[model samples]
Target: MKRIGVIMHGITGRMGYNQHLVRSVLAIRDQGGVVLKSGERVMLDPILVGRNGAKIEEIAKKHNVARWTTDIDAALANPDDTLFFDAGTTQMRGSLLEKAIKAGKNVYCEKPISDTMEEALAIARLAESAGIKHGVVQDKLFLPGLRKLAMLRDSGFFGKILSVRGEFGYWVFEGDWQPAQRPSWNYRLKDGGGIILDMLCHWRYVLDNLFGPVKSVSCLGATHIPERFDEQGKAYKADADDAAYATFELEGGAIAHINSSWAVRVRRDDLVTFQVDGTHGSAVAGLTK
Candidate 1:
């Protein structure tokens, strides 16, 4: 068996804890690891790292994870860890990836790699220079519905694809009468929060991979809710955009329009949906079905 040490950062958060750690890594471990093409068994040994020692310890104990720590430097310094994964706040993603790359660890991180294009490019350049494998998480493309869509596209189901329309997001409680579903920082511009920055990244890949390469874009963003309660039930100004309407011109003359908003009510089949129209036929894809 080949053992791969993965340094998991920010697993305390909702997405990190539920999606990455529990559903992905632990699930892989439970299934007796991964079997390679050569029938070699590859097991992942994850060391959870986070800011809160007590919370991380609790999670580790509950999950039966043997290693947990708050010291990022020490975790990065450990030569045993060959891969570094981050699902932390966007504000810190670039710097964290840079640190991991410099430490000679391969990196896999969540989207919006950096708040700015300059920093994102710099980190990409540095990772290339260091010769480390690196990737940003693009989970949407792997969804069953999207996979089906990809198959249909490949089979020429949508001949002469004309346009693609995507609708994503749901109403997040404002945390007054009901607690907000998303973290408050997502509404603060200073904390690298904005619907455009977050959802556009997903749309970019979706259009490029499923439709065609995007040539240009026109976007309009809005802060639908001006104020929202925080985790502590304290009211805070939401300076970041909570919604976005973007239109992209794809390379092959296919037009793509996406409306992403946290304030919208869901009357559709799913929380997110994409409908593609073509000369031959049309199809709709959502999170499922």
Candidate 2:
């Protein structure tokens, strides 16, 4: 068996803990690792890293994870760890990725890779120079519904695809009566919080892969809720945009419009849905069905 050491950072958060660590990595481990084409078994040995030692330690104990630490530098310094995975805040992802790349570790991180295009490009250049594998997490494309959508597109089910429309998001409680579903930092611009930066990245890949390459875009953003309660139940100003309405022009002459908002209540089939119209037929897909 080939053992691959993965340094997993920010697993304390909701998405990191539930989706990446538990559902993905641990689930893979439970299945006795992955079998390659040559029938070689490859095991992932993960070392969890985070800011809170106590919380991380608790998680490690619960999951039976052997290694847990708060020192990111020490984790990066270890030569045993060949891969570094992060699901942390966007504000810090660029620097963290750069550090991992310089330390000679391959990196896979959540989007947006960086808060700015310059930093994202610079990091890409540096990773190329260092000869390390790198990628941003685009989990939406792997969803069962989207995979079905991709299949339909490939089979020409949507012949001469004319347009694509996407609807996403749900109402997040303001934390006054009910606790907010999302972290408060998601509403603070200083913390790299905004609906546009978060969801547009997903749409970009979804459109390009399922429809065609996006040529240009016109977007309008809004801060639907001006104030919200934080984790501590303290009121804070939610200055970042909670919603986005965007239109994209695909290279193949297909128009794509996506509406994403945290303030909207769901009356649709799913929390998120995409409907594609074509000369031959039309279809709508959700997260699962």
What does candidate 2's lDDT look like per residue over 112-230, in tens digits?
88889999999999999999998888888888999988999999999999999999988789889998899999899998899999889999988887799999999999998999999
Worst 10 residues of 1 by lDDT: 263-272
Extract clashing residue pairs from model 1. Answer: none
* Displacement of the residue 84 alpha carbon in candidate 1, Å: 0.4
Q: Lowest-scoring 10 consecutive residues by lDDT in candidate 2? A: 263-272
How many angstroms is residue 221 displaced in model 1 relative to the true structure, after the best TM-score fit? 0.3
Residue pairs with backbone atoms closer than 3 Å in model 2 (clashes):
none
Each model's lDDT: 0.93, 0.92
